[model samples]
Target chain A: MFLNETQEEVRNTTRNFVNAVIRPAAEALDREERFPSEIYEEMGKLGLFGIAVPEDLGGPGFDTLTYAVVMEELSRGYASIADQCGLVELISTLLVRHGTPEQQKMLPDVMSMKRKVAYCITEPEAGTDVSGIRTTAVKDGDGWVLNGGKIWIHNAPVADTGFVLARTDKEAGNRGMSIFIVDLHAKGVERGPKEHKMGQRASQVGALGFSEVRLGPNALLGEMNRGFHMMMSVLDKGRVGIAALAVGIGQAGLEAAVDYAGTRKQFGKQISEFQGVQWLLADMAKDIEAARLLVYSAAMKIDRGLDATRSCSMAKCFAGDMAVARTADAVQVFGGSGYIRGFEVERLYRDAKITQIYEGTNQIQRMIIARELLRKGATS
Target chain B: MKILVPVKRVVDYNVRVRVRPDGSGVDLNHVKMSMNPFDEIALEEAVRLREKGIATEIVAVSIGVPQAKDTLRTALAMGADRAILVKSGDDVSQDLEPLSVARILAKVVATEKPELVIAGKQAIDNDMNATGQMLAALLGWGQGTFASAVRIDEGSALVTREIDGGLQTIRLKLPAVVTTDLRLNEPRYVALPAIMKAKKKPLEELALADLGVDTRPHLTVVSATEPRQRQAGVKIQSVDELLSKLKNEAGVI
Candidate 1:
């Protein structure tokens, strides 16, 4: 409601699309444990893949706030669908920001809504601490050699290509790491079985393995030993997207709670009229608003080319906690029905937990916040 | 072929809309405006032709307040070679159709003699959906609306439009007007260098009177008012009560 007319129209349009297309399919995908590849394909067809891509790369040439709006609507549809959309956003952002001119030339496929890309940074051991990743990227003649592994990667089994993080220098701490654009068909590259996850089950999370994966000089993203910095910088922007996603997930929970509270009975009274339940609903609404504002503020900062790392961390930390708490509260509002597998609130409860864990755990975000505050204190 | 794509300044389509007090129009004060979505489609289609090695030159043009240059720069970022802005003040409540805009555009079209023109179907602000068709009629050119896809071939081009029910294909002669929809093509973000280059792009300025067109509103705002407010529905106690209300009072069932 705080948005302008065009944004409202876009929200309505996206919501309508979700109501018509995603809602009907949500239960079945979870029921069957099937990845929502078709949904991602549809989103790509709608040009969802290039929301962050630049105009020269065949994107719609929108701003960072535009991305926040799109991500919110998408996540509201199905967390996995929106999560897949986020992977594409992250990859396209990195490619545009750091890829070589020749690499830049290949972005039309990504922005034209013709290709799928996975982001392979998280492995089994390196979800939060990025410097702990074991994936290795070594330079050979003019080309580089990558012989490492990644796990929990979005769309690895189905992705045609991906932005992969690999270690280049064993002793260089964050500076020794590097990112590469790995074609799925390249030599020594293999995909493991799709991961079975508790929530966002429809998202294709899997492992990618490398055994002397060959890459041309063009495969290097950013500078050698700059991959960790590049990844962290990009992840800062990504935190905004994840925050938007969390808020959207919270929104879905709030809507479910509101709808049920109006009708669900308790001791011959509507649950909504019960003060205890009403307070929970009120708390959910307030939390959603706060998280949304935090996310939006960070997005605005990113748009202005300001250092938004602290804001991003704050938003991610706050929204991630809000998503989990509100979703669980939504389950409480549903009473016994919320415990069932098929209910939207229950799914949201499960889906909300990961937001706190990924893109830097809320704990890591706190550390980042404390670090920034102390740094500010020292400077001032 | 030289082509001119006229874009518009509008609120970013992802934001919610609120009607202004006095009921005359939408409140635009402090609102985040963006390049009209449909205009983006038009710009993308034209720029694609440039990328395909078919277009001789692609120029974006807009007729709005001086700040409208920002929208034109977006087109330049998307690969439009140059731009021109006709000064139309910030307080814009005029008929936003192609006829009023075509008067200004006709001057540029006549001067530039571009073989094609593209624009969005309509700005979401008012939802008139008239500009491109009206421009085609005024300029004596053919028009294609709700264009989902466009393909260029030699002197002519083929356009695929997503209609209300299904799809339709139309082959149009060159130098025509086309309006874009969401499915037309993904518009690209202009890169940093392109943004810098867009700042240097030749964005000429013209006065509304200089084009000999009277920029007057044919439709007047009779009055402005807020939408009606409805009472919140009373909560139901049980599924039985819910069913009873749906079947009886609400009569939804």
Candidate 2:
């Protein structure tokens, strides 16, 4: 809520670009299920990717709140566009925090969108339970040979670099894992067909197969055996990013509902004049504002180096549910017209469900919240 | 060639402006302000010239309250080499008319000694369309207003102006004023990194007194009011009735 002048300027600049570029292409991009590479390149040039990265690392060095604000604004125009940025942020932040000096050197290219990176943690066997992952990285003559598969990997098809989580010691459970910076173009790295999603299709998602993919010792990210912890830290920020994105989707839905209600007439009067419609709009606005506060609070805590796990889960769960509900209401506001393909709210309705499922499902978020609450006891 | 581009801070064009209840002026409290859209066009044109290697340096100047520094920062982010903010203080009552702005800019031009001056045709907030012409008059330089296209060559600029009749081309000697029209190349989006770098760019602030210029309003604004809302029209039943309404009520017969 208390955005600094630089943060506000970032918001204005992103909003201007969204209005001038993203918004116009949103519908077409969704319809075609194609990623808008040109828009992404433009955003990369604008330093959207560097919002939360450090200035020394070639980032704009904005705080987490600024990142959230940018994500929210971009998501309002198109969720996939924001998600693409989120993926880049997650990788960059992870590298900055846990990567070795050589690995961190990739920060500039990632920030500049010269190279795109995908986080490969979610596997077919491991979604919520990352410990169940079967991906393995075996040591072989000073290098590691990785043989595993990752599914639901966002940016995989287009990514030039990948931060992969593979088991270095299969017996150590989660501690056995290590993150590797894999050159996606290298030998034995295969990409599956892009998954056709229900919404947010502007982002490419696919499965990645690594068959004896050889990696030099320098490819190890952060430290060996600490990949799980590093990933947990990344997930904390990822949840906040997802929450901010949910807020954007919800905000867009609320706007669409409000606009449609005011214009669409039913029974000789505007639907906005009807008490039922008014109540729906009021509820959506209230929920969106509450969810935004939670999201921003978690982001601020992260920025201040405070523990944000519980708050991040709460924000993610609540905002995700709120977005799904609000988008449904937005479609309802359009009535039969919203059921059509060309309607923006209809697309938003389709896009809202994934927020609940990704970056740990809403169920997983609630479990985390409950576990934290049980462990720490609720603060008064 | 050094280019001087003057920008203005006005209420964001997307915002719905409302007149103050007391008739003082537009209600600007808590309202979002941005670079005047036309001024963005002017800045874009200047940046394009520099990009083409025609202009060596671009100095962006803005005359407004301290907040105008933000507008200048935006200009700098859009690729202006440096910026100068002529602070007008917090008094909204100050005229800040085209002539006063032009005179202030005239002093800036003398000190900066730019070979070319580019400005927006008009600030959207006032739509006066006079600053460029006035600045050229004070500088005793050739002027081109409503410039849709500008090409610089051999100590002169060829500018295509959008006029009532059609597009008109004029060649102005070096050190002349060219006002941007809507069609003058689309402004590039200022990336976030550029904005961060812009903060480090030189942005010098000066007061009107620093420029040794008089700042006073030449015109008085009467009670500002919203336009009357038009009523919904009714369908005509017959030609005779339509004729009767046109002749008697509308008086457009």
What local lDDT score does residue A205 receive in model 2, on the 0 to 100 scale?
96
Tens digit of per-residue lDDT, candidate 2, span A1-380 = 47877787889999999888887899999999897878877787788885778778888888888889999999999999999989888888888887777878878888777898889998888988999999999999988999999998999889999899999997898789999999999999999999999999889999999998999979998889889989987788889999999999999989889988998988999989999999899999999999999998999999999999999999999999999999998888889998999899999999999999999999999999999999999981
lDDT of 1 by residue, A184-225 (tens): 888898999988888888877888899988898788888888
Candidate number achieving the greatest lDDT relative to the actual structure: 2
The most accurate candidate by TM-score is: 2
In the order shown, the chain A TM-scores of the predictions are 0.94, 0.98
Name the lDDT of candidate 2: 0.90
| TM-score list, all predictions | 0.64, 0.93
Q: List the TM-score for candidate 2's chain B.
A: 0.92
True contacts kept of each: 0.00, 0.73
Calculate the i-RMS of every candidate, to one decimal place: 10.0, 1.0
Per-residue lDDT value at B26 in model 2: 90
- Pick the DockQ winner: 2
